[model samples]
Target: MNIVLFEPEIPYNTGNIGRTCVATNTKLHLIEPLGFSLDQKEIKRAGLDYWPKLNYEVYKSFDDFMEKNNHPKVWMATTKAHKVYSDVTYGSDDYIMFGPESRGIPEEILVDHEEECVRIPMFEDTRSINLCNSAAIVLFEALRQNHFEGLNLSGELHKLHWND
Candidate 1:
């Protein structure tokens, strides 16, 4: 799967998302006009040693991303969407787009792709969740739908047993 961040503003959030992408084997796409430099130290601090392992690309613009990606199926995450995120069956190669930190995706873009938009259900009191949390939530669901393909599912069991 792929995670696309449009004009992300926060360095720490991007750094956390990059770490997630590295862990999940998901490609990260960052659109231009970013608020922080790619070489920002906060990003390195958040990502730690795994920052270098992040498979990602920087795009000049949304149109540039579209042109290079060959019209891949896109799923936009937004608050105005009707469908719940988990309701849609995600594909391994589907591109999931998240808007900037401050303002969400442009209305024009979301309107044009209304059918493909989704949202994480929440109480009306909250406007939205943090970018890194949102990305992890949706991406993991997508990974779940795809049966967690290309992921390491097994690790050494803990020494203590529940039955003990």
Candidate 2:
């Protein structure tokens, strides 16, 4: 599975998400107009030397990202959606998109692709979860549903764990 961040605003969050992607062996794509430079020291500090270990790519624009991957289906995570994320059938090639910290995806994009949206259930009055946390939660669920057997594994035996 791949994680696509659309115009992410905070470098620290991006760094955390990058590290999570690395740990899960997921490819991370960052769409541009980023708030900070990739070489920014804060980003590196937040990532804590795990940046080099992560598989990531930076796209100049969303269109450029779409042109390359061009997956037939994309699942956008939004609070406006009624469908819970766990209800969807996530495929291995399906790209999961998340928006920025402050503002979600642009209305034009969201409206154009309303059918593809999914949301995590939350209590009333809660705004939203952290971007990195949400990504990790959903991505791991997708991986779990797929059995997560073929994912990268180091030459070491480790105990298996699952969340919920």
Query: Which candidate leads the pack in TM-score?
Result: 1
lDDT of 1 at 27: 97
Among all windows of ten consecutive residues in candidate 2, which has the lowest summed lDDT?
Answer: 149-158
Model 1 off-target regions past 4 Å?
A: 158-164
Prediction 1 global C-alpha lDDT: 0.94
lDDT of 2 by residue, 118-143 (tens): 89899998999999889988998899
Q: Model 1, 131-153: lDDT tens per residue?
A: 99999999999999999999999
State how far residue 112 of model 1 sits from its true place (Å).
1.1
What is the C-alpha local distance difference test score of each model? 0.94, 0.86
TM-score (C-alpha, index-matched) for candidate 2: 0.88
Highest lDDT: which candidate?
1
Position 91, candidate 1: lDDT? 86
Clashing pairs in 1: none
